[model samples]
Target: MPRMLDVSNDVRAEIGDEEADRLLAGDNAPGAYDCTSCRTPGNTEQELTSTVLFVGQETAVLAFAHATCVPSQVVPVSEDQLRGAVRSITGEDTAPSYAPPVPAAAHAAAPHFPAPAAPPAYPAPAPSPASPATASHTSAPSSHAPVPQQAVLGVTSGVVLVGREACPALVVEPTAPIVRPGSPGHGDEFLQLLSEQGFAPVVDLSRPPAPNPGWSVLLAMGRLHAVLMPAPGGGRPVAWWQAHSPMPLSEGWRGAVGRTRKVLIYAAAAGTIGTQPREDQLRAALDRAAARGALVGASMPLAGT
Candidate 1:
């Protein structure tokens, strides 16, 4: 059986003519699939399907989409994001985006802190309260009530697979095992602390929730430069982690993130996933944490550097 396919030169250059021909012959391609871009149904036998490649530091994921929804192109992503996508496709447990129940006594026992100084200006329009539904496409920051910080989070960039799909993801590893700001002897409670405040642990990225206000990942010239934290009091996005110099990203990473306004974010309890060229190592570390239920995640829009 023959199928209508639009394999771009770039894809052809990477996958080669033999594979491309195989796809057109319906020997290797799927009959129907969810469009990588729109997440809607697509039939390769009925309509033209674009061959999209998601390239990361260590792996490449080939996905299909409607020609109208997404032109064939290579997307770059982090290992963590790719793993999440894989989970979604593989039917792994996807945590609910809603905040989990917290004991009233726990909240009552929480220590109080002084109000932070007035915050700075966020990028565009103010953001709205988070909903587990669709992500907000607006460039504006969220307007939710401000949340205070206790520990600093260290972030790394990579791609993850939801299933056979791939997308860019940010991996957050704390500089130190997270403890309350004033407490010096507290144990690692980073993921637990965020969970208590409504941040959910995401094992799958197929149906991620809208990002909470103030968190963003910045890419420039195909390099990851900073991870912006929400400013105190709903203020501007500030760099929670900025490279001493702009760090180059894996091939196609910036483009992958550019094509998709959304990016997945994963956080571990504490520990360095290592550095570049070792993204695979980082992926393994985070994977262990995720397996042990020590990870939290979200999908946020890309922000300017």
Candidate 2:
């Protein structure tokens, strides 16, 4: 028979005062709560709930009860024990909340801005002709042709073009993703990409470290933001992006293309970190970030690349 996994520590740690009370109150873990004293289940007869009493910063006591369970049978638990149980069961830390003092000067000033101008009614340009014979060319072409055609190149160009056309319409707003320093595996690479894209990468290290098994990265472009985290099967990180404002794509991101046109190429060159990411996944993540007025990009190194 396969050896049973050790759950004693996990159980002990996860069982907070509240959870313990619930357990004693015969609150169903999900379906049925068992009564240790009378061998009776609680939730079967009524709903069960719990209340928490914070004793200190790191400790809390909990009380639990089923609608049918007697008030006299409730058990008390310490905050430390309760927190430990939560960690063991969920593998997540309970974050503490801190309130910062507001600046006095911020409230003293009234906001001011220039008056808005009337909207322009410019006519749309006619479509360009494919053949030079029917086209009126005002500018001379550079001696060198553009970069060779490649699937990755095409994808990057498309992203840049979208940003350029959409920016002018006030649709795209540039934003950056929040990243923690010293995260394992390809975090530096992700940061480098953001810097190249003209974003000032900010690192927040105030919180305790998490068990980051695989690589994660964040990127942002105007109105494009993304957060890429590790997938369950441990391949490439998943990307999530969103747009921050409601504006037409054609005008929202105008003038941004020149700065970002080369970014996708660099990201593609970086390739997928760990296991290669699927094209759809990357595109989806980019789209999410772009929509949010930020961009989050990440790359994992393949073997020998």
Candidate 3:
């Protein structure tokens, strides 16, 4: 519809050049529709979008999504699934791999956190007119661990200075080697795993890391809650790393998050960074890790205020 949309070659081939051209001309497209991936409303006129065609044994349904969430493509569905999708009130399908555009509860004043299942929303705490705060948090209350192996993940919250800017940051390290699941080898795959999930090697502290789409940090009640990752098969997001109990954030760090609405998370293998009690010390450790290509990071958008 003369809207900014991406119709992949595969999708075009399946939908046919004539029908695809009709969609491109806006005759077969809607001005606004709910995103098939994140279930949020997107207007083709306002933002870049993708046209997803869901085909089944004997029928097909077209879906829309923000381009940032997923690229235009054809998703195969079962006949019963396609029929159920047509009967569904939302006209949405469940299996497309996608990232969210913006979380539904993203506008809360302070923070928003989601559980592994259904997450409850929380109101932001009252803001105090105090100076920006900084703190390093390691130990906390618990219910979950980062992995199923014998390892302790230490998460520290601190500020990383890039030139004159005090950027909010989180440091993750394990107390033991992290072995890959189902692998017989004992070699650590910590960075390898994170890299596979979209974290890139941090080359320079002077520049902020690129934002990793479909990945974000969840904070609630003014505290660190969990790091949310895309769902395994792509529906609601799930926690990639969660605190047993939410970790505390200082006024400064919290303020920094609220101001920028993004968190810079840096990770390294165990012993590469430990007992970084001060912000300066933490920054130094990060620099050292980056020097050796041991650091991986992403500037993730906050799911809440």
Candidate 4:
């Protein structure tokens, strides 16, 4: 059967003008599909769309996007990154990559940041009755100290249902399991760290915490770059977590952030959540966090690229 598609000059150059013409005439293009970049409904038969190519080491996938979301250009990404994007779109567990690697310099030049200065010190440990006079100096919590090595937060986006209503959600997973800064081989205390900073534990998604201003999600070049948190010592924003390769967020997500001026951010201390999960799995995680009162909800303004 003929396919309906909009072939950009760049794509045409790769696929050929004859094929491009055929696609325009619904001869070589696929019918309607989700825009790879924006995750919105797009049709080659109705509006101009870009044919995006994803190339990996041994596999490739052809994806579609709105011309506005991504101009006619080739995007070279890692195989894992490409798979993540596909999982977000298809609501599936696995996807193969197609775009070839871009210049090494392009990937290497992406911004990098050291972890924020140790959060305000944790409360001092309880004083020992036997050492009442030395308590002030001796009772300070050993856990308040900073870790020798820094950790990174890996941010992924997905949808969570609240009573059958799908809500745009951002999941934060730390590169290393988060434990108290000075507590090696200890239990994860990541959620506790956040709670100390005023991210009220989420007891229910239906009832989110009041909006907290000054925090925002930063996007650059129409991709997920970082989640900004208020500076430790009171200055400009600091990246709580950043991506080595910017991840593309769906258009619906962008719109949701703009319209709601809020986002549901959930964090797990020991492990991370996949972009794609069975509905039951998602709900189970939600129930677990709600049970522990560890989920965090905040109002984050949208900052676009």
Candidate 3 TM-score versus the reference: 0.54
Stretch of 10 with least lDDT, candidate 2:
113-122
Cα lDDT tens digits, model 4, 31-116, are: 67665544456677677766665444443445666666555544333454455555544445323222222222222221223355
| Candidate that would win on lDDT | 3
Model 4 / residue 238 / CA error / Å = 1.2
lDDT of 3 by residue, 146-239 (tens): 3345565667788788767888898877767665655677777878878888889997898888788888786533456567777656764556
The parts of candidate 2 lying over 4 Å away from their true place are 1-16, 20-28, 32-192, 195-305
- Summarize candidate 1's per-residue lDDT along 173-204 as a digit string, tens digits: 65445544445455666676556544687654
Clashes of 1: 26
Higher-scoring candidate on lDDT, 2 or 3:
3
* Best model per TM-score: 3
Q: Candidate 4, clashing residue pairs? A: 3-29, 38-251, 54-98, 54-99, 55-98, 55-99, 60-98
lDDT score at residue 158, model 1, on the 0-100 scale: 64
Give lDDT tens digits, candidate 2, residues 54-151. 12133332222232222222112223323433342232432211111111121122111111111001111122122211111011111121212211
